[model samples]
Target: MLETYCNASGQRVNNEKSSIFFSKGCPQVTRDGIKNTLQVHDEQLSDRYLGMPTDVGQAKNGTFKYLKDRVWEKIK
Candidate 1:
C-alpha cells in the first residue's frame, strides 16, 4: 500500500541519482497507483517527501530543495 509506494518511489529516486544501484529493480510506480493510494490514505505522497530525513551535516536547505525538486519533476 502506501508504504510500498513510498519505498518504491524512494528506491527509484535513489537509483536515478545513483545514490543506490539499479540492478535490484526499477521502483517507479504508476501515477494512478500513487493517486489511488493517496486517496485511501487521505494524504499526498509529497507529504512523505517533506518528512524525509537528510544526511547528518549535509546542507539541509540545498539538499532538501534538490530532492523536492527532483521528486516533483518525476511526478510530473
Candidate 2:
C-alpha cells in the first residue's frame, strides 16, 4: 500500500525517519501488522504535528489558535 502510494505520488518515504499514525479505534493486531509491513515505528502523539494539533480535544479554538494567529498576522 505504501509502495503504491509512493509510486502514484512520486514521493519517496524514508522508513527510518517516518512514523505512522493510527486511529484510536484501530486494533493492536492491525497496528502491529501495519508496523511490521511498513517497517516503520508508531507515531508518538505530541502537542502538534507539522504545526497542527495531533489530537483536537473539546477545545477546538485552543487547538487551532496558532492558525488563527498566523492568519491575523498575515492580515496585519
Candidate 3:
C-alpha cells in the first residue's frame, strides 16, 4: 500500500532504513501483523533511533548524554 502510494505520488520512501516500533509488552500477533502490514522490521524500544533513545526508560539513563557531549566537543 505504502509503496503503491509513493509510486502514484511520485515520492520515494527508503525501505532499507525504515522500521516500526511498538509500545512495550505488545502482543506478538499484533506486532507481527503490523510488521507485515507495513512491510518493515520490528525495532526494540531500547535501541537508539537517529542517535537518540527511543524509549522513555532508556532516555532517563543518560543514553542521550553522549550526543550532547559530542556537540560540545565539536564546539570546543
For 1-76, candidate 1 gives per-residue lDDT tens digits of: 6468878777432322222112224444544465454444232223233367534235677657867898899999
For candidate 2, lDDT tens digit of each residue in 1-76? Answer: 8789989999999987778888899999999998998888756666666778888979999878889999999999
Clashes of each: 0, 0, 0
**In candidate 1, which residue pairs get closer than 3 Å at backbone N, Cα or C atoms, i.e. clash?**
none
Better of 1 and 2 by lDDT: 2
Q: Candidate 3: how large is its RMSD?
A: 3.6
Residue pairs with colliding backbones in model 3 are none
By lDDT: ranked, best first: 2, 3, 1
Candidate-wise lDDT, in order: 0.47, 0.84, 0.74
Best by lDDT: 2
Model 2 residue pairs with clashes: none
In model 3, which runs have C-alpha deviations exceeding 4 angstroms? 1-9, 42-46, 56-61
Best by TM-score: 2
Q: Candidate 3's residue-wise lDDT over 1-68, tens digit each?
A: 87799989998877667777777789989999888877778454446666666665645648667777
User: Native-vs-model 1 lDDT?
Assistant: 0.47
**Candidate 1 Cα misplacement greater than 4 A, ranges:** 1-58
